[model samples]
Target chain A: MKPSDHDNEHLLHHFSDMDQQRESAKLGMWIFLITELLLFGGLFGFYTFYRAWNPDIFHNAHAALDVRAGTANTIVLILSSVTIALAVRSLQLDRRRRAGKFLLATVALAAVFMVIKYFEYSHKIHLGQLPGKYYHYTGIEGTNPHIFFSVYFTLTGLHGLHVLAGMGFIAWLAIRTFRNHFSAAYFTPVEMAGLYWHLVDMIWIYLFPLLYLVG
Target chain B: MAHATAHKKPHVLPLKVYLRVGAALLVLTLVTVAVSFVHLGPYNLVVAMLIASLKATLVALFFMHLLYDSKLYFLVFASALGTIALFIVLTLFDTLRRGDIYEEVSRPITPDAVIYSDTARFDTAHGQALPEEGLMPLDTAGIVSPPLDTGEIGEQVDTSDIGRIRTGPGEGGR
Candidate 1:
């Protein structure tokens, strides 16, 4: 099929037009998000198993977490999620400059989340609260407190990596958006990236309370 | 009618809706933190998880555009979550029900379960003060004491001399 101003110029021949292309792209992203959910699910499953087996240890070890840092990062990610949502809205409305700015804000907020995560991780490391057999912090003691750090580091480290990846995606999307490549007729990339960014924030929404506020 | 398929735009959430959802998420996070400090015993975990799930729902609905999206997308995500929940529940079912799986009555005893009276040797003589058969040193208030001369339990250990954590399997090699 030939491209029309009504559809996206980059529409492929296999797809009939841009709407078809956008629907297919979104469905594809949702499929990919399913797999991503499963990937995180494996770690979360392990966490549930261990947490159930040793509730006391999980709670005790989690008490050492910095609630302030966790809370701050939660706020940053929530704000970033809002910004990314706004960026997608702007692209849908043909406001390329405003969309680019929102994307940049999302990227900056994601970086801040990563920076705060780094500090939280470093403090844990300095206190010798390492994972598995390497855990050496002595204040909290329960049956295998090391296992708590094991789950903690695994979950949060994976989450931090996702944040970094989302930032990269948004950064690239922002650049393309500023190049005027995206308009109301064609902003699929921005939407897909925004979905991914939202998943990052979604994962942290659970992680904040799971790891930090276990009580 | 056929030409109508060419211009189906994606749903764009209003700016106000996005802000409302974001504000709700932040408020829920605050509520999660505030509730964690309250000692509701077992209910604390449940409440924390409930709040976390609420926050996750908000992100998925508003931030991910699932609320306005096709039902197929929401179905896929919900199915994925259901599968994960099933896996966790099943695995925990096996792990939680093994009360007697680790117990070994026929084997040689491992030094009387490492009692408080003696870490190396199991001496019933030191436990003579206790009414029970175990070596638990209980005060009149019925509190177990650590073998160390340090203060009561929950005190931070002397971590100044603590070296790097050991890094091996069953090495206990600090």
Candidate 2:
């Protein structure tokens, strides 16, 4: 082993250097994201089947949900995704301060998404519209409206948890950026976190329509 | 050699592309909401889901950089999706088959005997209180009624009894 091999603490010693480590990390994250998509895919399939079988019930239940809030959240998540991409770009350019600013913006946008989601959920619960056996909306005519609420809450709740997780990840990346931990040559952390954040945003892109915009 | 590779140029998308992607997403959201108002029957849900899937693809491709990922990552993603597809098909088959099983079970039993008179009356009223019948005159009375005893219902249907027979032979015994 050469003297350069001694500095392989960050490189994991298995790969040749930092570039390989970065590539591996990026690949691993993509694989993890694929699994995440699959995890949610089951719910998506459930929604598809139930909606196909009981279109009227799903549409009526979906109408009870707030489309305006969902649309606002969709925009918020999309903008945050853009900001995180820009943060990665800034890091690639070795603009640490600019990168931190973009990351902070991304975090703020994520907070906005969560705040909007919180209000939407509280409004629904206040109106006695809950998931599963607790659903109380009886005026609407449907075979099993509870099933709609069941899938709605399950999918959106899982997506919300992911958004929370992404917020924490972005915050950590922001802190590291502030400390000048990433450079043009070593910004894989920011890139990987951006990918995860984008996945969270992507899931909402589908959820907004499936849950709130359905007629 | 690896250090030299690390010094190579990084891949980055232009700001304009990001802006355009954002605009496209916003447009798609509006389009989906607008399309929901028209009654397309079965197609409405299909169209909505398709648009949502398209939106997800855009985000995954441009925002998440799946477009830039290596082939191995794509394979991993494809396999996961394939597994999820199998899960969906199998579960749906089971659910659909359950309805058939329920119908077969109901055919062997006398349904009218198992029906609750109060429940039947409530349904007959079109989910409203019929003033003429004077049944359940007060809303609170229905809610405050004593809970039905499971043992009583079970005892009423005995296997040895001819008129009131258990639907399943081993059901009540357990």
DockQ of each: 0.32, 0.28
The sequence of per-residue lDDT tens digits that candidate 2 reaches over residues A102-196 is 99999999899899989988987887677654667666675557667778888989998998888898898899999988866577888989888
For candidate 2, the per-residue lDDT at B164 reads 25
Where model 1 places Cα greater than 4 Å from the true spot, the runs are: A1-7, B1-6, B104-174
| lDDT by residue (tens digit), candidate 1, A102-149 | 999999999999899889889999998988556778898665577688
* Candidate 1, residue A126: how far the Cα is off, in Å: 0.9
Alpha carbon deviation, residue A170, candidate 1 (Å)? 1.0
For residue A85, model 2's alpha carbon misses the true position, in angstroms, by 1.0
lDDT of 1 by residue, B1-174 (tens): 232234654376678999999999989989988998888888888998898898888888878877877788899899999999998888877766643343211111121223222333322433223334444345553333333433222221111111111121322111
Model 2 per-residue lDDT tens digits across residues B54-122: 887787777766686566766776687788878888877864554333221211112222232334333
In order, how many clashes per candidate?
Answer: 0, 0
Q: How far does residue B47 in candidate 1 sit from its true spot (Å)?
A: 1.2
Q: Model 1: how far is B167 from its true place, Å?
A: 26
